[model samples]
Target: MHQGDPRDGAVTGLQAGDAVDLGRGTALLGCGGGGQVDHMVHALRVALGADTVPVVPLDGPAHSVIAVGLVGSTTVLEEKTPSGRELPDALAAVERWTGRRADAVVAAQIGGVTGPAAALTAHAAGLPLVDADLVGRATPRIDQLSLFVDPLPTVTAAAVTSSGLRIVVDAPDPRDLETVWREAVSHSGGWAAFAIGPVDAELLAGRAVDGSVTRAVRTGRAAGRARDVEHLAAVSGGRLVARGRVLDVQRGGDAVSFVHGSMAIRDAGTGAVVRVEAGSEWVHCLVDGEPVASTPSCIVVVDARSLRPVSTDRARVGDELAVVVLPGAPWWWAEPHRTDRVAPRAFGIDADPVPEPGQRPARGGVR
Candidate 1:
C-alpha cells in the first residue's frame, strides 16, 4: 500500500501505492474533470515502481517550491504514450535556461495525470514534492494559476519529451507563456512536460486549498462502499442526473479541449431510457434532451455499475457511465471581478444560467 511521512524533511522515494494515494487527492481537487483516474493511477505505478519519492507539503518559505507539469491536450496524451523521462528532461531544460534548480516541485494544478506527472518529475529530478497547487481545482489553461492571476511573471519554462525533443521559453507574461507553451506542445505531438519557475510558498499557502490530498483519500475511501450509482453520488455528495452508453463524440476545435458526446441510460427497474450530452469536463448534462446543469457546473462520468471513473479521452461507444452533477466553485457567482473570471460566460456561453431551485449559486447570486 502507498504510505509516506509528509513530515519527512523532503520528498525522496515512492512506490505504486503512494502514487495512487497522491493521485486520489488530485481527483478530489479536480472538482469533477481532469482526466481518467485509472490511467493516472497506472501511470503513477509504472513511473514510481519501488523507489520512494518524497512529497513536501505546500507550506514553509517562499521561493522554495517550484511548479512543474505538462501542457497540451489529454487527447494527445492518450494517443501518445510518453517515455516517462519527459518530465526530468523538462526540468533540466528549465534549469539550464534559468540557471536555477528547483528544491521542490508541485503539481501546477490538481488533475488526474497532472499530479502524478509532477510527482514523477520531482522524483526523477531528485526534488521533493510540494503540497500546494496554483488552483484549488483543475483549470483549462495554465495562465489561470493564482501566480498568474496575481500578474506574477512566469519568468521561464521548459518543454521536454523522451523522444529527444526539448524547448525553452522565457516570457514575462503568462499569456505569452501560454502561447509559446501551446505552440511547443503542438509541435511535440500535442503534449510536453514542463517545469515552471518557483513561487512564494507563503503566498501559495494563503490561497491554496489545504489538505487536498487528504481530501481525495477520504473521497476514495467513501467510494469503497459505493455499490450502485446512488451510493456513488452520496459518497461524493453529488447527484446522478443521467446514465447511459456513449453514442458519438465531437471535439469542435483545438480551443475546445472538450469531448462532445451523447449517452443513453436505462432505468434499472422499468428499462426506460434517458440521454445526456458530455464534453471535456462535462459542460452540459441532460436528461432526455433537457439540460439539467450546463457549463460552470461539474459533470462527472463514473462507471454506471461499478462507480469507477472514466476519462473523456477514454470514454467510448457502448461504455456505461453514470453522469453526476454537482455544485461548482463558489467563486464563480461573484461579480465581474478578476477573481470571477471563471463564469460560464468565460467558456463562450452567451447567457448566464439560473441556479436550480433550492441550490445556491456558487457565489450566492441567483444566476
Candidate 2:
C-alpha cells in the first residue's frame, strides 16, 4: 500500500497487454535461457480478464513477502500443462509451514515465465505483487537470489512437486536451501512449484531490486518497437556485441540444465569467432577467445531482423543473430562478495568479471 516515495517509481500494475510486452522483455532478460514464455503470457492474460494485478511498492509497508517461481524442465511443463493447482497448493503449503500469511507476492526471479507466474500467484491469493525481484535477471540457480547474496536474516523456503508433494526447508546455510529443495525437485522428475519467504520487509527495505517489474515492462515496450537488434539494444541500454550467423549450437553439458551450452557466432562484419557460454543462463561471451562480457551482466541473443530474443534452445546453425550485453543491476556490482556469487567464477567457469560492455572492445576491436 506504500506508494508515495519516488524511489518506487510509477509502475501502477500489470494488465493483459503488459503481459505480452513483459513476456518479450523477460525473454530478453532471460539472457538466452528461461524458456519461451508465450504460454505463460497467455495464461496471465486469461487470468487477468479484467483485473489489474495490483503492483505494490517495492519497499512497501508489508509485514513480509512470499516469493514464487517454477523449477524443472520447461519442456516437460509445456507438455504437461499445469492443473492450476500448483501455485495455490504451493502457496497454501508454504503458509501453513511458515505459520503466517504473506502480505505480498514477490517474484523470486524475473524471466519469461517466473515473473508472470508470480503475478498470477498474487492475483490468486488476493495479494499485491511487489514491483521487484530477487534476481535482477533470470538465473539458473536459486542461490543467485539477492536475498542470499546480500544475506538478510531468517529465510524460509517451500515447494510443491508436480505430484503435489510438499517440502519445506529452513537452512542455516543459504546454499543448502537450494540443495535441499533441488533434491526434492529431483524426485518430481525435476519440476515443482515453489514459494520462499516470510522474508520481513525490513530485510527487503533496500536490498531487493526495486522497479524490476517496471523495467520488464519498459523492456517489453522497447522490444516491440525495435526495427532491428541494434535498435532494441540502443533503446534498452544494452550494447549490440555481435551481429553474426550462428555457426554452432552445443546441447547442454549437464543433464539437469534447462538450456545450457556454448553457441559459436561468426561475427558477420569482422569474421572473428565469438563463443557465448551458458548454464541455464548466458554466462559470458568470448570475443575471439577473450572473455569480454560476463555475468552478472545480461547477455542477450536475438533474431537480427525481428529483434525477438532467442532462447538458447531455439538457436540453430545458420540463424542470423545479434548478441547484446546489458549492464548488470548495480546491486550485484556494488561489492566484491555480491559479484562473487553471480560472476562466471561462481558457475565454475575459470574467468574473472570482465569490464562492463562499454569499456571493452566486443569482437575484432569493434563494439
Candidate 3:
C-alpha cells in the first residue's frame, strides 16, 4: 500500500484512538446535523477492536476510489441498527456495476456516523480509507458533494437497504441521481448505505477535501480537553457568539426528509436573543436579527455545563447552551459557484452567509 509523504503532513494511517477523535470531530463538523456518532462509534469500536484502519494519502496509488455513506433521517437511524454488512454489500454492488474493484474508500460526508462507517467499511473490504472526503462537513442534500462542485462524472451509484434490497443507478446528471436515490432511501425504511464513484487517486485528490480526517481527529482531541467556551473556540477555530438558555423552537413544515427547524436562544447574561435555523443541518444563525453564521460553514451549539455538542432535535426550553460558529471548508467559500450551492439563501434564508474572520474572499465577496 502507498503511504503519505511525511514532509507534506499527510496521515499515513488511522490509529486505534483515532476513532474516538473522528467521532468527536465529525460531530463538530456535522454543524449540528448528520446523525449523532454515539451508535456508530460503538459499532466501529467493536468491529475494529484494537485494529487500525489503513489510510491512503490523497497522492497515493492510482486505483479506483469509492465514496460511501448512509442517507436519511437521524431520527430513524436511532431505531434501526445496521447489520454491519450494508456498506460492504453496497461496495460489492458498485464493483459489479462498474466491473472493477475499488482500491480504497472515501466518505461522502464526514459527520458523526458517516466517517466511522466509511472507515469500518474500508477495513472490512480490505482496502484503505483515504484521509479525505467529498464533503468536509455534512450537508442535507446528496448533491452537496465536492465532486459535484467540480462536476466530476459520477459513473455509477449503488445503495443497499437494511432488508438487503439493493439498487444501482447510472446517470449523466448528478442532481437527477440525488432525487432518485432520496426516494429510494424513503422507500427503504428511511435510511440506506450508498456507494458512488470510481474515480482514481489523482482525481479524488483534486476534487475531495484533503486532511479532513486528520483535522477531525485533532478537533475531537481538543474538544475532549477544552475547559470552557474560550478554550473550545481556540481549539476548534470557532467564535463563541452567545451563551443562553433555550426560549422556543419552531420546526419548519417542509416535508423534506431532513431536520428542519429554528430555535430561539436567549443570552443568559444580557437576555439578547439569537435564533438558529436548521435544514437537515444548521443553516443560519442570527444574533438579535443579524446574520452571524450560515451553512457550508458550521454553526454548533454546546451544552454550557458539559461543553458537549447539542443536536437540534435534542435542544429544549431552559437548556443552557453556547452557540459557536466555525469556518466552513475553505473550498466552499473560495468560489462563487460553491458558496451559492450552500448559501443561507439556498436554504431559504433571506441573508448571505457571514464569513469567518479570516476567510479567503469569495469571488463575489461573501455571498
- Which candidate leads in TM-score? 3
Question: 1-367 in candidate 1: lDDT tens per residue?
Answer: 4454567423334467666656654564454456545566686688667776665566643365667776777666767766777877777777777776667777776556787777677777777676556654566766666566555545677777534678777788877877887776666677777777755577666545444444454455566667788887787667777666655554443343333444556544434455544444545454554556654455667778766666555566677767776555443433334333444444444335545436555453324
lDDT of 3 by residue, 1-367 (tens): 1234579655566655567777898998887778879878777777777677887667777479999998777788878878899999999999998898899999998866898899889889988888888888887777778887766555588889776779899887777777887787778778888899777777777778887777777788789889997789888878888888899987755544254789899987777899999877778888898887877778888888888888877888889989988777787777887887778776766677777777755768464
Judging by lDDT, tell me the better candidate of 1 and 2: 2
TM-score of each: 0.77, 0.91, 0.94
User: lDDT tens string, model 2, 100-145?
Assistant: 8899988888876787788888888988889889878888777788
Between prediction 1 and prediction 3, the one with superior TM-score is: 3
* Cα-based RMSD of candidate 2: 4.3
* Most lDDT-accurate candidate: 3
The alpha-carbon root-mean-square deviation between model 1 and the true structure, to one decimal in Å, is 4.5
Backbone N/Cα/C clashes per model: 18, 0, 0
- Model 1: CA > 4 A from native: 1-15, 24-40, 46-51, 61-63, 244-251, 254-279, 286-297, 313-319, 326-339, 351-367
User: How far off is residue 142 in model 3, in Å?
Assistant: 0.9
